[model samples]
Target: MKLIIGLGNPGKNYDRTRHNIGFMCIDALAEKWNVTLSESKFKGMYTVVHRPEGKVMLLKPLTYMNLSGECVRPIMDYFDIDVEDIIVIYDDLDLETGKLRLRQKGSAGGHNGIKSLIQHIGTQEFKRIRVGISRPPAGMKVPDYVLSKFSKEEEPVIEQAIEKVVQACEASLSKKFIDVMNEFN
Candidate 1:
């Protein structure tokens, strides 16, 4: 089974904020695949989807952004899922808005959520899908920028990125991570 985790803070207050892009992507996937993330466990909300190639557990950590791994580690341990079978999707400030990057393993690049995952999971050998949110403008604080909603001009770009994330998730069900990276990254 594969564990696909989308890292973000929970609740309506965070909705549509740049920092919640991961949650948005997960929501899109749930709508596309007709699965409901109605079950609560492991400090998160999750639903299992059975595909032709394998079973995928879609998770949204309710532990908030900074302590995401607290939610991830337990689910992984309980499910006996290997690091390679895990795919995490989250926002990135390095790339331009709407861009996506895939990596097999790497540092968190200052993302607290990813940092937490790396620390709690005890490894950086998992796959990640980074949806770009772009850097904050001059004089703007990163926290403020991330917590803010996208501008009108950026809405379409973010929407498209979310769609692509859903496609990448579907492709991952049957293809290798590298292949998905080649196709989507």
Candidate 2:
């Protein structure tokens, strides 16, 4: 089985914010796969989809950003999932807006959510797809920028990026992750 996790704060206020892009892509994937995250476990909302390739779990952690591993580790253990069979989707401040960078392993690069996951999961070698939210503007605080909604001009670009992320995830279900990274990165 494959466990796909999307990291974000859980609340309506966080909806569509730059920090919630992971949740946004997971929501889109759920819709495309005709499954709802109707099951709750380990402080996460999730559902299992039986695809032609295999079983897939789509999860959105409810433990907020900074403590996301408090939710992910237990579910992974309960389900007997290996680190190699998981993929985490989250936002990144380093790349240009709407860009994506996929890696098999890496440091969190100062993302609290990824740092939590790395700490709890005890590995830096898990798969990740980082969606770029861009850096904060001059004089803007990182927290303020990440929690803010996209500007009117950026909406279209972000929407396209989310769609591409969904597609890349779907591709990973059937192809090797390295191939998916090469094709989508």
Candidate 3:
């Protein structure tokens, strides 16, 4: 089965934060597929769904962003999932807000959560879905920007991004990552 992991911190206050876009995307997917994320395992929340191709696991890691690898590695070992079958969704500051980029494999590009995953997984040869959150406002610390909740003006744009991200997840499962990138990138 393919593993879809959304990266984010775990807390009520973090629900709508910029850093939690990954979690938000997974939340939308769970809703669409009638899957519940309450089944906690593998250092995350997940649900099993059977699609035409096969069974799949939609996961939202609760490793709070930086130590995501700690959570993902054990699950990968337990399931014996190949790197190619893993897809991680997380926020990116390098691209414009609402932009989405999927890479089959590459460096973590300075993302701590991803960095952790790469270190633990012992490779960067895994798929990734990066949703841009845009650079933080000038003068603010990077961490401050990510942990802060979205502003009122950003709500609509972010909500729309979430919808697209959910669709991207579906597309990834459908084995249409290239098309998804073409449409959303």
Candidate 4:
């Protein structure tokens, strides 16, 4: 089974925040596949879907962003999933808003969520989809900025990016991840 994890803090208050783009993408995929993340365990909310290729698990870590790895590692151990068989989706402040970047391996680049993941998983080698939220404005704290909601002007763009992420993820289920990256990135 392949594991797709979207990083985010769980709660209604966090819904639609810039940092929750990962969750948004997972949600989009769930809707597309007509599945529900109705199961909860291992510090996450998830659902397993059977596709022609195999079983795919969509996960949203409920440990919030900083402790995401705590949630991920257990699920991976329980499922006997390899690091390569997992894909992590999260917000990126380095890229422009609504842009998407895919990498097979890389450092955390100061992202606490990724940092925690690397600490727990013991490797920087893993597939990742970075959905750009853009850097915070001058004088705006990073924490505050990440938790803020997108403006009406940004909503459509982010929605498009989320749709693109969903498509890329779906493609990865059948095609090699590299192929999906080539097509979508």
For all candidates in order, the CA lDDT equals: 0.93, 0.95, 0.86, 0.95
lDDT (tens digit, per residue) of candidate 4 on 19-97: 9999999999999999999999989999999999899999999998999999999999999999999999999999999
**CA lDDT, candidate 4, residue 90:** 95
- What TM-score would each prediction reach against the true structure? 0.98, 0.99, 0.94, 0.98
Q: What is the lDDT of residue 13 in candidate 4?
A: 97
Question: Per-residue alpha-carbon lDDT of model 2 for 15-79, expressed as tens digits?
Answer: 99999999999999999998999999999999999999999999999999999999999999999
By TM-score, who's the top model here?
Answer: 2
Task: List candidate 4 segments past 4 Å from native.
Answer: none
Greater lDDT among 1 and 4 belongs to 4
Residue lDDT tens for model 3, 98-171: 77888878898999999999999999988888888899888999999999988888888888888988877777
Off by over 4 Å in 3: none
* Colliding residue pairs in candidate 3: none
Instruction: Please report how far candidate 3 places residue 32 from its true position, in Å.
Output: 0.9
Which is better, 2 or 3, measured by TM-score? 2
RMSD of 3: 1.3
lDDT of 1 at 93: 97
RMSD of 4: 0.7
Q: Which stretches of candidate 1 lie over 4 Å from their true place?
A: none
TM-score of 4: 0.98
